[model samples]
Target: MPDAQKMFERITLPRDAGLPVSLCNVSKTYRTGFGLPVHALNLVSLRVPSGQALAITGPSGSGKSTLLHLVGAMDTPDEGSITVGELELARLQERERAAFRSQIGFVFQRFHLLPALTALDNVAAPLLPLKVGFDKQQRARELLAAVGLSGRERDLPSHLSGGEQQRVAIARALVNSPGLLFADEPTGDLDSRTGAKVMGALLELRSKRGLTLLIATHDAGLASRCDRVIELLDGQIVSDSEG
Candidate 1:
């Protein structure tokens, strides 16, 4: 097998370079039934240093997904600011935000793989939209191998196990060589053993690529593996500590 480290080196930023994420007094509110305003996040603020692994934990209504969405640029905050590296996300124009998102990878709980596409095609799909000028297929193949999906590139999502499908999703997320990665309950669909294996692969990639990682999960075991953990309750931060 090709060395995973070498494969990562081809797509990673310099070892000394890592992106820092900062949120200052961020808040988001939603209008629900009866025109009532639901505060999804109330003055939430945090900082994740470069190359650090941070876990976000909370109960079902604690705004974990909302927080992840804001940080990942999938949604904008109604108040305060979120800055990744030197770019202020809230202030970016729509086109600029799209460009910025291209530099960040997101892994959702559902894996989000197209069932009809082979693993290789699924990983390469993002590149087509970005108009990236390189061999997308080669990069996709390398990422699949790096994620230990070698020889399974031709398999459809249905053919793979839950863990295998998640791995493929991870490979797809990394295809653009993002400087930061966001995962929301990446292991939620898998058994414990498989979850552990998937987490191991994620951390290994984070270390090798100098990529900042932020994960939102309810599993304490998974949260404990991160460098730090933040707990939320009722849309507010209740505690933050080292893992």
Candidate 2:
């Protein structure tokens, strides 16, 4: 019988239209509580394509969070380089770093919402550092409604449930329409059902807006939902598999 199909693999996809993030030999070290040097990331190099949802999965203390921080330009690496698009983070001044951060959205497991500020104000905080005025308020409210928090816009973080708070954080992250979105254990604080809902919201954003995503999580189920999973062990990538 004739061959029915070719078994060869297809060509690798070209890089996305715009650069999202690049890390070259990045490493980070910290002083442990016992005063000994602890390696968080060791010569880790990675490139996150624009509009791809990538997950970094590892156990606690495996440097996943540290990597996320570096990618988002929230913290500088102790060694090597991290460049987002054409901007080299290490070479930029503090003010420039802050500006770059404004272009990236970040979500944390702790929610990190202000106790005094309403959800609307919390989402509007990122715009405060920028000079863009008047429109920021409207943008914040719009984003909050987009994340399904329309009725709870005036509620404080303390009044919102864990899932609601995470959704609010998502709105805050997207308020600036950041080119990159970083979430560190975004669903770790919620129950399984709520976690799934939050993950759905994130996936929806990635699909609708072409947002680049880097999610750090220990939940295997959540990681499996991403397009690719990079597994880390002892500050090193043990496996990178496409989903």
**Evaluated with lDDT, which candidate comes out highest?**
1
Clash pairs detected, candidate 1: none
Model 2 lDDT per residue over 1-243, tens place = 211111101111122332377889999999988999988999998888778788899989999999998877788899999977677878866665656676678899989998999999999997775554369889989888878889788899999989999999999998767767899999998999999899989988887766888999888998899989999888888888852
lDDT of 1 by residue, 105-173 (tens): 899889999999999999999887554458999999999998999999999999999999999999999
Off by over 4 Å in 2: 1-19
Q: After superposition, how far is residue 145 of candidate 2 from its true place, in Å?
A: 1.9
On a 0 to 100 scale, what is the lDDT of residue 153 in model 2?
A: 81
Candidate 2 Cα deviation (angstroms), residue 213: 0.7
Candidate 1 colliding pairs, count? 0
Number of the predicted model whose TM-score against the real structure is largest? 1
lDDT score, residue 182, model 1? 93
